[model samples]
Target: MVRLMPRKGERGNALLVLYSALIYLFLYLPIAVIILFAFDAKPIPGLPLNGLTTSWFAEALRDEKLVGSLLTSLRLAVISAALSTALALPAAMVLAWLPIRFKSLVMSMVLGPVVLPQLVLGLGLVILLRAAPDMVGEPAIILAHTTITSSYATLILYSRFLGFRRSYIEAAMNLGASEFTVFREIVLPLIRPALISVFMLAFTDAFGEFVVAWFVAGFTETLPITIWTSLRQVISPKVYALSSVIIIVTLLLSLVSQLWVIRQTRLTSKAPSA
Candidate 1:
């Protein structure tokens, strides 16, 4: 048997592979640990597995506070996503297609929340909500979340509209279609994927938001606030279990969103020639 020496390019490729693997491991090892400890029979999450069990998951689901907070989060996320996307759709279209005076000023206001720190945004909302103390809980949370999510939603939809083929709209107008008719028949169908992507992204952002929600949540708790509260007391393995579920769901959502967007892009690209 003959031993072969690795070439210079082969050595570089091997190092690159090793480097990429290390990066991935660094990023994902903690998530893997959390997932593993979620199932560990140990009452507390830590190293050295005691035994494998699924009781934590059951316990997490059974915890009223956790379940309630999760439900609250879901409700807020859905409402925020829908409201933000609906608000963003028209704003995005106007920004992308129409020429208006003070465009820069208008855009700066629209995008202000995105660049502002969540801490500051929350504090500002707290001040604003002082006038109407009635809106300090779930309602306030929904408002704040929508405020943040709408900026992102607008950006996404604006980008989509910018890349849109104006020919379609023009063709509709040439055929004497009203603006509403054109939007209902032409633009909406074309941008359905983008709208869905914006909604999902907004939902995920609002669902995971902590600082803003914490400030406005008052007595009502969202999932992140609940998790933070739990951390201050005796940490529960159920938290880990719930977290693992969230992580898995988020990963699935992200993967699905990416694939859907890519497929839509490919279809849109082929539509013109077809």
Candidate 2:
């Protein structure tokens, strides 16, 4: 019996698929390992698979310090993400559409936090906060996270606005719509998906940030700080359990944000009927 040989194009496609699969596996295998160990009955995480158990998750939830820190992180991340998005919106609009001198300098300044080392940024913020001791706890952490996350928010919105149709705004103006009305009715609706995506990304970044938060945290504890403290002593399986929860939540948020963007793109791509 004669066997059919695959064409060169088929071999190339197969290789490309295999290459992509390997890359994804490399990136995600460590995360999978952590999730697996979180459910493993083995007290110390390692090879030789132990029976699966959910006790670690319960223990993590029951730990007052861990739970409290998780809540604090949630609160901080929400406030920071909101504040960052709020600040970034106007800045991105200006950068994307407005004609201003020294625009490059302004952009660089806005993005400084993202490029600067977190340790140095933390130190700088610590020094700045010295005068105001009252803001050394949650307030300080929120401010620091906002400063860092705003840069990313700005970048995302700026890119979105760069491709935005200015004709919409001009048409609104011709129809006697005020700038505020135009923004609220026109720009806001178009960019809502981008805004939501930026907020989700900022929230995830702030939630996981530890270095700057550690510097300005003072007596305040976040989940990352708590995990770091736990790591100093004997590591607990509960830490892994908590981490798995965070990873799962982050993945969900990311997936939702991506889907939102994709859906919006599809909806926008269809031309309006005559």
Candidate 3:
């Protein structure tokens, strides 16, 4: 019997699958190495797998400096994400639903930080804050993170608002509801999932951020900055353990936020037809 050759479509699909596998391996190989090395018993994170052990995690947990830096990172991430969301929501609503002149220019300004290099933004912030040296610690880092993350929050919220049905607002208005009342009753609930997703995304970005934080942190050491400093001295097993924990936490947070965003999008799409 003659073996039938693969069709062209099947050949293309096989190539696509191979390409995808390669891409995933490229992206996750380092992460896999980090997780594997986190269990290495050796002080140095190197080959030969110095016998599997969990002591490095305990060492990382007990390191007072690492613990303090993790706490600082958490605080900064929460404050910055909340502030970014708070500032972006109203601006996004206005930009999406209201007619305004130079709207493209306004959006460009809001998104400028994303296009600009972090090193440049950090240096600029440092120069700007030099006038008031007192604001160089946690406040400066939070402000810098908020500036960067707010653009992302605004873009997400704007997309949600743009797709929003104006009929809801109009209906509430016809019933003698105030604008604030309409927003509180009709808008907030519908957009709550998007809001939460944006907040989580911002938190994830800020939590892992390092460059801008390094420049503006002054004496304050966030987890990323702490890790950077430690790496310069030595690639400790503790660092690997900490990185593994962070990787798990960040992946979980990002996955949940992305899933929530997708679910909210599906709900919104179905609502219009229903």
Q: Highest lDDT among the candidates is held by which one?
A: 1
> Tens digit of lDDT per residue, candidate 3, span 1-274?
7759988999999999999999999999999999999998887778888699999999999999999999999999999999999999999999998999999999999899998999999999999999989999999999999999999899999998998888888888999999899989989988999899889989989988999999999999999999999878978889899989989988887787788778876786677532
Clashing pairs for model 2 are none
lDDT of each: 0.92, 0.92, 0.92
| Candidate 2 structure quality by residue, lDDT tens digits, 1-274 | 6759988999999999999999999999999988998988988877777689999999999999999999999999999999999999999999999998998898889889999999999999999998998999999999999999999899999999998888888988999999899999988988888999999889989999999999999999999999899889977999999999989988987897799888987786563522
lDDT of 2: 0.92
Between candidates 2 and 3, the one scoring higher on TM-score is 3
Lowest summed-lDDT stretch of 10 residues in model 3? 265-274
Query: Runs in model 3 with CA error above 4 Å?
Result: 1-3, 264-268, 272-274
Residue 222, candidate 2: C-alpha displacement in angstroms: 0.3
Tell how far residue 46 is off in model 2, in angstroms.
Answer: 2.2
Q: Against the true structure, candidate 1 has what lDDT?
A: 0.92
Clashes of 1: 0
Can you write out model 1's per-residue Cα lDDT over 1-274, one digit (the tens) per residue?
5759988999999999999999999999999988998998988777777689999999999999999999999999999999999999999999999998999899899999999999999999999999999999999999999999999899889999998889888888998999999999989988999998999999999999999999988999999999999889978999999999999998998898899888987887788631
Cα lDDT for residue 220, candidate 1: 93
For candidate 2, the per-residue lDDT at 97 reads 90
